[model samples]
Target: MTQPPPPPPNQPPDPQGGFGAPTPQQPEPGYGYPQQQQQQQQPTEPGYGYPQGAPPVPQPPVPPQQPPYGYPTQPQQPQQPQQYGYPAQPQQPQPYGGYQQPQQPPYGYPTQPQQPPYGYPTQPQQPYGGYQQPALTPSAPGGGKLSAQLQIVIAAVVAVAVIIGVGIWYAGSGGDGKDDEAKGTGGTTQGATGGGGNGAGGIGGGGKEKPPANTQAKMAFQVPQPKVPDVTDVSGSWITDKAYVKPGVNSIVAYDLDKGTPLWTLPLTGQVCGASRHVSADNKVPILFEATKRVAPRYYQQCTEIGLVDLNTGKLVWSTSITGGSAGDQKARFSEVTLSGTTVAAGGTDGGAAFDLANGNPRWKPQVNDENCYDMGYGGGAGLVAVRKCGPYSSQYVLVQNLNPTTGAPVSQYKMPTGVKYASVVSTKPLVVAADVGETAGDGSGISDFFSLDEKTGKLKAKITADADQYAARCRSTRVEACSQALVGNGRLYVPTEEHEGSSGEYGDETNEVIAFDLTTGRTVPEKADAGDKYTLVPLRMDGGNLIAYKAPPYDKGGQIVSIDGGTMKSTVLLENPADKSVRDAETSFSLNGAELAYEGGRFFLSETLVSKAREGDDRNYLIVSFAAGH
Candidate 1:
């Protein structure tokens, strides 16, 4: 689906206007004290009117009077002298004319009515050599006045202590409160969105370290074998820490990836031809296209039905029938189904139809007369794409159209280059990369060319003459397809190449090379080595900044899965296929349907098919093996 435009840049307002400006910093809470009241100034001494007269007489010295209230006064002599080695007690002060005398202590050692020395409060005398109590001011009842610098220091200490305590509590409770809540509600640590703009519910493409090569493979889960007429297709999609699998033609099951327990299952009455998971901002559901036949006495017919079901509950949210006709009418059935945003589309020979995933109501269905329009599949997050042929079998011109994901209408259309009957879409966003397929050369070699198109206007951006013959020769003896698969990632299109071997047909040789083309410049990237002899690595999918690949040597058996550093091209084996015979056979069958490696929540998954032979008969079983990273 067309991705929503990015939010506008957040720009701070101009200082001149003062609009959207940041608020002035306020004093930290609990660190600031109320402004000190201004001290009152004493009235200026009255000017002497007789300044010019004779000097005043000198005054006599007088004994000091009792200090004012709240101020410490000098200590008075004891009432009586004490003997040697014995402490002397000072006499109590007389009550002031207006103020009440301080209360006496109940713990004996009579309260000293006499004021102690300045900066020191009266306290009971300590024993000889004992620890002495520190002197304290008696300016105020609650606390004494402190200097401004001292107050700042005290505030800083208190602020630091509070911060440390909060940090400890946060660490103990979990780093992020939202993440803790998600975990409690069964959310995974891996990113919800998958690579290739595939959407949210699939296996996450974010960086997930693979398991060690020596780690053992264990079955994480398996669905009970369901009896069906035939197993048309088997596929799996990741939903949080669980996997949703269409294990059989008439059954879809969800299993917990870690515990291997079945969560739910929905049995079907017809064969599912196409299935995909729609992942939006708030919801994820499986959309299935099934063809069911009804055998009535006079009417034997089949109809195509599209449905949406909850992933966790297996409840049918909504379903609608698309086409109803004779069972043998091929043109009346939808051959493929895909999801984009809130729209689910199914394409077939006549044309294609779309329905709103939210409510299962028909959105639109474009009609193309006498031409087969097939769904080319999702262009990542760009939108849905389809190819329409103009002429009959003898001669035809291929037309490519970018369909509006919301309305099922063509946004742009362009005629492909002459002589190419089909194009394989590699990406659909900022740039569209496709490989045009043409007839094989007279020398029995394949012919293919890569093209880049502008996503907005469907105009040709660039073209690269692919060396299909060289690639075919390299994989001639291997089970891997000779046709190069184009993978776009990190602003470059990776094109398979056999440049190292050239045109040589050396026996037992394998190809492990890919030429990267800069998307913006349309030039080959020479900084990266196009080939390596250390391992037979075939790029599968992009995992964050790294490229996940499969070691292709042991094609008939379980092989090593490695991750290639995107910048250095260094290969590290992440997982190895089990040495068991059943696993080997299963890997062979699994490889027939492209690569089976998937990463989700720091774990890797490989879906395999196991065949069990028994006295009664042989049964085919499907099992998904999970390999946790660092295990």
Candidate 2:
């Protein structure tokens, strides 16, 4: 690697958006669809948010500005467990094109929900093209009616809705979710297995589970939301054959996959800050949490504790913290964590560290001797990778390193192109990285182009330039391991295109497609996964060499899980959720881009990474919602 010109003041790479700043609120779900009485709808793309062959849709008057998304100075006293809010989430990722940027409140502050955003049209806007639904029926015949397969599915949904009555899905009936209700994790593997996308970014893997005879699902169980004085971060979640593990308050709780009840509760001292996206072979994961709970004026604590949790047995097999040079003997803090090979690594503005995944012994501590350079962060899973920044802050460049997990040494290193402010490790094994060169990604997604590199030799393979407005992938500005919404597998990168008008321009028909890019050639693949109309498809993870995606529900339909074959891109619907209003309401409550979602053994799990204090009229805010189908 070239060592460029030298000698200037050194500073860490800075990305846009200061930590803890308030972001805007989101549009509401469930708008009504306008009907066309006489004429047939035709495919049109002349303009966005417009119906074909109809007069321009009237835009509503802009609403009042919403408050920021952090907690107030005076926190609200939460109500009893039985009286939480239901589905009316105040702050979420914006609809249409908002990127799911990572936003954490400053140390002690919780997010305070602001007033509602601008009112949407009474009739929801339709967004899509006339692409045929992949893995299912062909496109709509003439009018805007749904496909034959969808019609049948709707009928089946109604039948099941009558049988189940949406009664089981609501939070009111579920237990209050007290800590005592937990069935302790036996400290054993429990025959569990890691369930996640490939080494890339995704949370769940359903490749091994066979499609049920009736793919439609019924409500399995839901974990009710707990009261927080303010917005709290509980960002980690994982799935195994036996239990679905989620971090709550300062504890990690594993709940039975079939029953919403807790399997075991592993308590922690501080609140959970970060979780490993990749799970170990034996169902273990590394986590970063605070050293102590927030109190009085000292609102927040450094995310100083790094620990490995045995997911199967609910045991904190090992927990420890280390001190850095002048950065302080006061315990090093980390912004993110990952697991690779036999190592667990943590990275942040405070340098980086690694530990043996098996026993939690320190592999290395943060080094501050090199004032001109620092380890910005590391990404792991399939392999361990790091982004090291050096040179003066003015002309600093980054080296993306493929590391030897055991020694914390770079096996190979690639120098990033000049003028790159920050870089994120999308996947370590495939050696995919993303950056907003010249800060061109104005959408706050913190990505502009993807660099496919040679991990073994530290060479450039391909550079896939992504247009922020055109692509919907996200990576938090300075967190090296936080890129998401983009799936990498089968030597291809899958991302959703922006939503557009669908065939028969009608209200509420927005749609999009998942297109693939060859990592080897940096060229677009011919096959695409279309979300049909009215529904938007987001690629979740890869399953069995296929793409697992979530189909966002339209005004009257429920979400569907479809598998797109890697070779042909032909999609197959694996689970079709009920469109019944109550069920749809609960399912949509978990925002599409912001929610933590996964599927295992035919069970679909939706979870929240953060929660806040409920206002006076809040109903039953649920923390986790589960849907399952089987023989």
Candidate 3:
């Protein structure tokens, strides 16, 4: 899946005209009381009668040096007669109400120069009262009085502004009284729209409610890692060989998943089969093992024997015969065998066949063309057998067939990719089935592919290709093919791949990794180790859906066990083994229901490595994990 895009940058702020506050208008000219009085006097100068720019002329020179007698002195006596005698000539009375008037000279001033009173104008007074306050006329722009029409216009604008402001306030506040009446079912104002309205079903007013608690269920089997044993050839499933144990021999010993456990100093019985054969389908019954009487080149006589002691009573159960080949045949060997329900199905060097649980009756037989159909597994509601067929001419045929456990009928068969056929079945699921795929016959240098097959049909599902042959070279020089890459689990399939050499020139002897693939979906989880990382894999029995994958430390034999809880799709490391000891690489592993049962390092081991919570009592703790169906 593609990744999502990044987010955008933060938005810029919006602009508002100015600061959004009211501005003070320039004060109207001459508006204040004292300032208006000064304005009224400005008009008076305009109405005054004085002529602009008029200059005064000198009158006839008065007789200066006049004596107190009102006559000129004798030194200026020549002009004194005209000046002193002229004043007494006539004190004529003025026509208007004048107290003393100068001689009315017709040529000197106006002939009828009758003046008004001292502070009045020269003209006779009219009937109108004083000045009439100049009728308050409109003035110019400099220092003018307001006209009547302008005053009316200003008043109308103020009224309109007030009306507009009131209308805006009303609209913003939800349309005034009409809205209030329409929404006043409860006779009160509300802050938000439809706020505190009746809720669904009209039960109570709406408001916030709390979230509910988590109530989901989950699966509980989380498998812890298994303890390492002190042995090599640790491959395939574990078995107790209870079907062939002698009466006087030791019993009930614990061992690791790989090797047979030690009872005091005695070796476990029937553990050294020619093909290393062991089979147990029902956990309730004793384990069945194939004990070849002679070596591979000699007489090939085999028997399917049972332990002398029972699991519950410690008593010997009846031994059953597992007939394989003609007494003269030497190449015949028991490859894979398992008990399904009450019937037992065994695959061998010649062909595949079935046996009855009650009396060992021959059910059916089918031939295998593969030369190396050497391994068998039973779990996923069916039984499977891995084969290496040698076909016509020189073809190396490799295949695995699903068989009817009761009748040995070939239900399904799978043919893996060419040149990638020598493999061991690791684990299978509904969607993806996995197996170890590579050239395991001799010293090879090619890549290994982990094949996943569909459980329903025997078709190829997916492939996880890696280099297992290179990894097995360094794991140990004594390792065999069966014990090389043994891996199995429920949700996971473990495929061991070799790690490539780095620039450090440090060949850590053995560098291997267990590749885990999700079986539900045919995908490799991202949690897998980096390519060429080294590790080992040990698959415990399926408990339910959840399983465990144990991870060993890098460059060290000792490691820790990790429980993989399937429902959560996660793994947690649980047990940490001691660092001093090297792990015993065994080939066998088994599970009784959810528990792991094995025998390695000289003891029989049974452990409930991962158990569910639903079955959690001391009495119910033991689970009989079997890879078989009911009778």
Candidate 4:
């Protein structure tokens, strides 16, 4: 949703400013942490992140979501899952000491009075493992130092903790699954993601877009949202040297990167359901779409077509589909798509298939078997990995397999820990997986720990325990490569901490920071990028060794695109959007959960992936809103 800078250590907490300032919360339970909240369940069979108490309706299996801020300006729809996007699992309110009202959506709900605007804010106390020791903020201005006796007591406690930690590591190495508690050199290594953007030394090298002379951007053009009767999915966006590409109702369209005018449009017979983020060296991507649009009675068309689109030419080079298994003669329908090197792959409940990226040549077809171990999904970036699920629907575990892109065979396989219903692949080469072991992250954020494994050997290197409340990184429960705000590069796993009270200001500001964990040591590095007060930072993607991030604006400001040094965590604003009121309101309206963002060549684009019919009198809904600096 955004980008951020570190503030001075000690400042007064503002009683105002920032979006969605959360009141202090009682420590919450996560993946492996102890539960302090209680709940209830329905008698119906459970599906991944299914609506808790609703009448059952057929839908795709989706991940859970933590509480998300809704659109205040747009008309308020019922608090239900849209036809697209993840579903928020129902949580029963637990009895506390006092009565608690149900949570409210942002639109139409009465907002609390506005507080004064604050400046720089403080860092959030990072949560360690699950214990959540109090993060000691710097003493407020002029605060006195600790006394000598107190210092000595703190030292003794630290010494005892070190000794106990070492004992746990030793005992954990001996098995009994206690190893889950130990820190890890996650993934053991890191490699460049397979696009030309990862130039040597992590520079956005290779004639890639360079920072503009003036980083301030004025309003460019926007793609208006097409009205849809039902919630629709246009969930893909990308950029190249010449154009910005997006998928619309039943076509893939490209627009002039600077002018925002249409470059060309490639028409298709049906709607686009999914697309691969990785663009091949030739500027081609494989997208999954339905064979035809709704034709009444059979309103929901199956996603049965895979078409390779040439971004440079805006043409559909070839299209293909497979048929077998349960569907018999009907083409197989897939829910996911990814790319690695020269191979394009698609996976789903029906089966999985791989095709040559250059031509529609089948490399492999679904094999008949009773193993029940299907490749549920694959992650593509620096490497190709598959999350293979086995056992019956009642009880199933997964295997993370590093696959040969062309052969579809496992080069190395790592067994995920027990009791993990689903695992999200964060990276493939260094091979990191995120999961909520035993459903410990009960708030529906979908992750509590990150497992770093050796991609070549499939051996475990380290396990990183991150509290769901403390970190904002999320990987959709089953969609590999569906991770937002979680970035990996430079041999490190980077994540933004959840927003907290800022360091200084008349009205305390809300802010967050980006921190790195060593991919080899599973230890945190000193590098961190703070989201300055009044804005929030979300990791967009990596630019060579540097990180490309978006700085989500507050009420009065437009968004920003920043480039951060991987080693120093120093952020350079590459593109600062207009601060004008109209533009700022338009830019901030897109929700973080449903928005698709891309920044390249001084152009920053924010688009809504899920759209529905807007009510009369409401501001125009946007499909793609853009800004360009030095264009």
True lDDT of residue 257, candidate 3: 24
Clash numbers, per candidate: 0, 23, 50, 27
**lDDT string, candidate 3, 1-631, tens digits:** 0111121111112111110101111221221121111111111110011233333222223232222121122243355433211111111111100111222211111122222211112344322211222323445488886788896676567545543321110000100101010000100011111211111122121211111132111111112222222111112233444321221111232222222222322223343222222233433233334343233343233434433223333333444443332212232234444454565544434434455656556564333222222222232223443332333223343444444455443344455443322344443333232222223323232223344454444544334333333232111111111222334444444433333332233443223333344332223332222212233334333334333434433433334344443333344443433333222111112121222333221222333322223422323222221111111
Decreasing TM-score order of the candidates: 4, 2, 1, 3
Give each model's whole-structure lDDT.
0.41, 0.62, 0.30, 0.62
- Please give each candidate's TM-score: 0.54, 0.68, 0.40, 0.72
Worst 10 residues of 1 by lDDT: 180-189
lDDT of 4 by residue, 1-631 (tens): 0000111122112111111111112332334544332222113322211233545333233233222121112223455452221112211211100111123232111233233212111334222222233446333348977777776676567545543322111001101111122233211011212112123245332224467999889877888888777767788888888888998878888988767889999889999988998888878889999998865544578898988998999989999998653345667778889999988888766656778888888776544344344556678877888776654555555667677776665566555655566678888877888877666665555776787777776655556666666677776665656777877777778888766655564243666788776554454554468889757788988887778999877666778898987766778888988878788767876766457888877878989777766878778588888888954
Better of 1 and 4 by lDDT: 4
Model 4 C-alpha RMSD vs. true structure (Å) is 17.0
**Candidate 4: global Cα-lDDT?**
0.62
What lDDT tens digits, residue by residue, belong to model 2 across residues 1-631? 1111121122112221111101111231221232212122222222111123544323223222221112111223653332221211111111111334355321111123222111111333222221232334324667566877887786566545433321111111001111011000101011111121122333223365467899988888878888777778878789987999999988999998878888899889989988999998889899998988877554577888999999989999999997663356677778889998898888766667788887888787665543345667788888888787654554555667677777765566665654465789888878888876556566777776777776776545556667665677788757788776788877777778766656546654567678776665454544566788677778887776678888877757778888876555667888988878788778877766567878776888889877877777755477999888745
User: Model 3 clash tally?
Assistant: 50
Which residues of candidate 4, in runs, are more than 4 Å off?
1-158, 164-210, 296-298, 505-508
Off by over 4 Å in 2: 1-209
* Two-way lDDT contest, 3 vs 4, winner: 4
lDDT of 3: 0.30
List all candidate RMSDs to the true structure.
34.3, 21.8, 52.3, 17.0
